[model samples]
Target chain A: MVNKSISEINNRIKDGSVNVVTAEEMVGIVAELGAQGAAREVDVVTTGTFGAMCSSGVFLNFGHAEPPIKMQKVWLNDVEAYTGVAAVDAYIGATQVSETLGMEYGGAHVIEDLIRGNTIDVHAISPGTDCYPRKILDTTLDINDLNQAIMLNPRNAYQKYNAATNSTSQKLYTYMGSLMPNYGNVTYSGAGVLSPLSNDPEYRTIGTGTRIFLGGTQGYIVGQGTQHSSKSGFGTLMLQGDLKEMDAEFVRASTFTGYGVSLYVGMGIPIPILDEKVALATAVSDADIITQVMDYGIPTRDRPVVRGVTYEELRSGSIEIKGREVTTSSLSSFKRSRQIAGILKDWISHGEFFLSQPAERLPSDTVSKPMKQTRGTAMVRDIMAKDVMTIHKNASVFDAAKMIMDVSFNHLPVVTENNILVGIITAWDISKAVAQNTFDLVENIMTRKVITATDTEQVTIAARRLEQHGVSAMPVVDEQHHVIGIITSDDISMLFARRN
Target chain B: MKIRIIINRDIVTKPILAEAIIETGIPLNIAQAHFDSTTGEIIADIEDTEYRMIKNALVSRGAEVLRLDTPINWDEEECVECGGCISVCPTKVFSMDEEWNLKVDTTKCIQCGTCIEMCPHDALSLDV
Candidate 1:
């Protein structure tokens, strides 16, 4: 029943008598001595994670211009910044893409550029008001010119996250990186044993106002992040720090091929060992933590979980998926994570860093929810044409073409006598059949692998599938694979048109 | 030493690299090789002393060989030693040293170019 307070730990740190070790090192210490023994021996356990945190941004107060214009809209280095706050204050989100430079440059790039001491071009437009008369301003400013540059991230330092793999046959570009076709590779992003929240999984030591290392400087955990779900083992932190004091080495900007830009943030937290329970929690290892490998091919919010895997299996460079071995790549940097933890431990041991009692403990029972869309919430069944005419697989190509032309439809579903969908034949397929001089059964020319929509599926998902497969329409099928209806690009466009 | 050999359309059918390896008695680790009907390109690692010998043998066989000085450029100054490139690289071009610092063995780089895209710092690029 060893008990110690943060004040006691700070006193030890001040006297240069505190025994500080990284979470990775604490694992061995706890294993050597029991948790109770280790709690008496160790004072603080440092943890770290360096990965692409897309929900990061900064609040900048560019001092008032000479003419004093109220900035209604602002662009920092061509990347848009939300400027609805004050006269010259704006919050630059990390994921905002550049208008002129496109995905090549973004808000993350602008932040990194500022941290690197590079000058940024600031352009703003304002509808002139009585008090503030200036209309437009274009200027270049460095990080030094800003009255306050604060890095206030909404979500960061995820305790654990799902590993991503593609089950589809197409190369899927996602925030998880380029997932190869047919589960060719897997990518997981987290620092496994070295993660900050993983060390304090219960949010016992990490919460509001907990002192932390943010981008190589001292920072604080503001509160739980936007999607913090500690109950599901994927807790997140909201952090705040002085951006002007941040080191460029710890802040970086990255661009995913099709997904746009993100910011890689380096974050560290020191967990003071108050008791044996705290010691045991801080000693958690890669093998102890479990996370699901999600199939990223599914674009829906609730992606199917492929399998449960331990971080030990992930960090080993490979994991088995459906009995086949797939090499694993980590988007998070473990090497840098270890360095960050080591640096935090050094700072604590040298008395440069101190632990603090959190102002409020993070909720352990929180569960995240999907965003509710206010518009475009229609289901596929609502807009799909009902009782669509179908051609039999045994029918000739000419019959399919005649059915498509007569019904004024570009695609016709080939079905069995029981109305079970077998394939789909487009007018283009019939034309290609005629050009090749081969007029045979509709099954021979029909596309065997047909993209389909379900009655219960959201229209947005069906639309995405059509666009992904490069098709203008899809057969709406049921659980029995019966062609119940058909939905086309025209039907979707018409729905939006009616809504407007 | 790493070198990229470009076999012309006429000599692509012949085993120029295999013959060069045999002539110089140096083993070649071919990291990446692409072949078509008209042209062949190979990037391989060889001993430093045998580079000139292999280049001369390859050039005699109507192949253009160039030392690979800048195929994949890793900017050390900008890199924070993140291990983002380690697992994505098929040929194991990146690894961690004793201090958990990133180490790059460019000889094994197959130029898959995934690492360049995966790097968060934009610290990696292909010169070609």
Candidate 2:
């Protein structure tokens, strides 16, 4: 076995003889050759993961449109893309839900479309200026037309991620994947010790400016990831790079049905065997990385802690949560992770890629508040029911009654043709009318004047309205006078459930 | 261009691929393949002109040519473009344009169909 230096590895990389193995494969080498022998023989260990990373996005300069508008408003396929930058530049966030499709589509889909080299419909309405006269430019877009497409993510590759489950009776649609009610299922995001940042707990060789395989392209670590808690069970890092180098497949957009848009970031890291210590770091397996399984149904940053459990427990297909052994599945792919590790290993061995020394070490001094709760940013919009079951003006009285009994809901907002909140009927009102045998047209029994709330209103406003009206639920309207959602008492109760 | 074909359970014992080559003059390049008594899904490439000939030959040999609406099922309605499929895509069929819209190239696709596993949207799937 030879103790190959970085220079020697680079030299071998040039000559196409660099000895590389995936972190999965390296475990076997150490078992056969021993840690010291394997450390001397191997130059690099590649690690990877493909999972839903919400903190991912792209910055694109669309160049100048014909008679360019200083586009204030931007939408890619009806999903809002941020136009806060210069006129031609837009930052397409991965989580921005489509105006048309709502949470079903978003900016992550926009990024995927761009990478696929498909034409994107770029529609922008601007408050026109003399310098930039166009008020609206409806145009088709091709990725090549952009001046710059930067993949600048504030966070990715969580060192250790939580396995989320539900304790409450209601199912939670979250970025944590779908948390079934009554602990029916758990969705764990961590690749366990196979997780990139978790393997390098101290961030020795993997750090800022480190070349990494990101979304099928070479990307670098830019800075500290948000909520980067080194004090927590694992170390996290933030990264950025050019989107141009990536394929459309690696950086994908996904909508978790009701949960909204999220990006599946494909990432790979090369751990150079600097010494036996470094080799040992790569040896850390699923059994070593202890992570938490939080109750997503608990609804707060400081969600109800189920218990600390190892990734081995996580991967066992079920976890013991609050004395109940609940089943668990992965949002992150095990197959893709192994595939990425293999790809990196081949790239190093065939001299197609070379590892570079990170320009800076990952900062250890960074403060990550364990209580960094995002409760302050919680808006009425986030909690509002986007899809409310409404009784159509023409629907029969039995149907309305059944809707209430089926869901045990108190209020039913009656909607007109354009989804206008025409009137509201309560289960209490229905019982009174039915006792009187006045079960004819709903308008005859339903309240003609309905107190309503708009989707843009604050939680305080909705809460105030509910108190003032002494109502269990209020219809939430949008600008088009559409009944977009209903603010129910049960929905408001969720705020308090997570407050502790 | 590449297309996928399913094998009948009865034909699981038959060398259908070999028969396809013998019966049809066209050459088939199997990029990705999976076979079992329950199912035989193969993604194979052939010249455009040979599509009908290959279909007829395979059909005669107890094979079902899976006619896809588009073998690459990309639903723009649900796609979030998070790039889960990019890393595992063997053909690089999926990518993002300048506008960040996920675009698909059926031409480059060998129809490996790995995107179905990684899509959080449940938006992508091959007809096969």
Candidate 3:
């Protein structure tokens, strides 16, 4: 039995303020009051998770200075910042490592420093210009000094992340955290009932533009996360939020020792108990949310799933794998997750927080690509460079030349101020410009008409297109036509290697 | 019949191996030796009975001994050098070199399985 419309809840929320219950309390409510009664009483169920996600990053719009350089190259406290957006605006990626400190310090650290009200060493070098004269500038910048600081993450809070274990006889260092040898210890990321997407299960309420509590402030989901998948029944989303409102405690950077850097983002999503189903989904216990155990020792796209286990068994500190008791730990801190959820619950119960209908629903049909398959065809995403290093159209010739020389990459995906794929510049293009003494601006020399491949399209099709166009690489766009990745001839050669 | 021994300054400054051989009248060969100011480690080959006799003599002389089947080998392809083995190893067997790379002292390792359990990647094992 279900009875409660979203409008009725919103109307009550508007002025007729009603009481609220937490995701944890809702568990007790349904057990006692039943789903119908619980749904009628609690307007919304607050869910949260604080986890390390490398795909997370902060976008900063630095207000133009007296003599602002295009800022072709930018670094904050020695950590490289992607200045491929607007002239002054930059994006600090969580995984982007520091030049001097290596992987020990990264963009995530810079964001944390900014949030902590600490001034960071800002360094930028640009070729001399007429309109924008400042070429070399070194200064200190705090988060408050920036015009806008927004948290726009590509992926966060994986709904059913795998539990990590090592199957090989030796120990391996991976981004999944330190896995003890021979299934010595297991580590899982999902916080079960405390996870936001786990509570939703279905994307009925939490979707695009759904307002959420992000790091102690209000934020909304912009669109689907890069690896949005449910195939097993759930909705995952990439989220965006204003950085100026977030708390420093909830937004921090962590270097995973041997692994790369990741951001510890605190997110609280409210699930409106519109019906009994929503209430039931919100009541899911740790035992209900099942995830697979994966052995990273066998390094392959098709990493073997040792077995399926639940958060309950994982949180218990040990699980049986291959008839041996292996110690279990968590990569995502559940204590932090519960703390965030408790904060959200307090806000909702106090009528300080309100739930908003999603501006747009996240597509539930987005399926994850299967790992094992007979060799025949492969998607562009399978071979494309997902972590692409891009060059802004406004970048200087010197900057472009330096980048091309540094990485020794031929093709540079030229992005506009809005991060939209405009065109590309090749080594030949740069060489030709340099030979003629015309390599001044990327926007001036970059080819505007760009040939691109969609993520889902077959690699063979992309290969044929590349051959027809006589290009070495092609940009891979998503359904939204955003340049998500780049496919190169080197990546496609693997398709041939698969034959042997 | 092959083993490695870690000796303190008291045993290190003395010709302990030669003394042990002469005392036991056991035919032994010193395969390799590494010595420093206060400590030393030596690899030697002998008969099984003689090896045990040497072990007793070394321990009696305040020397730490480790039996070895073969030298321990590192699988480089499988190792990312996380340095998990350095702490668990009691003999200071596994250490990070100047470049922070996991370096194994074959002579010092006792095959205690502590490092094997500590290593997340299965990279170290006795070659034998």
Give a tens-digit lDDT track for model 3, residues A1-500.
66677677767766747666667777888888887888777778888887677888888887876787888888889988888886888888988998998976788888878887889888888885887788888888788889999989988877778878898666656676667577766767766877888888778887888888887788888878886877655456788888877876677676665677878788888888888888888887888888899988765576899999988897665689999877665656565677778887777666677777887877778787766766567778777888776789899978888888987878888887667887788888888899999959988899888888888787877897788678889888766657788899888897779766
- Give lDDT tens digits, candidate 1, residues A367-461: 99988878758999999999698999999998888898899888899899999999999999999999999999999999999999999998988
Ranking by TM-score: 1, 2, 3
TM-score of chain B of each: 0.74, 0.74, 0.53
**Candidate lDDT (C-alpha), each:** 0.89, 0.77, 0.76
Q: Best candidate per DockQ, number?
A: 1
Enumerate the candidates' DockQ scores in order: 0.36, 0.07, 0.04
What is the DockQ of the complex in model 3? 0.04
Q: What is the lDDT, from 0 to 100, of the residue A403 in candidate 1?
A: 90
Which candidate has the top score in TM-score?
1
State the lDDT at A474 in candidate 3.
89
Shift in Å, residue B24, candidate 3: 22
Error of 3 at A325 (Å): 0.7
User: Tens-digit lDDT track for model 2 on A226-254?
Assistant: 87777664556687877877875567777
Question: In order, what are the TM-scores of chain A for the candidates?
Answer: 0.94, 0.76, 0.73
- List the lowest-lDDT window of 10 residues for candidate 1 chain A: A369-378
Q: Pull out the clashing pairs in model 1.
A: none
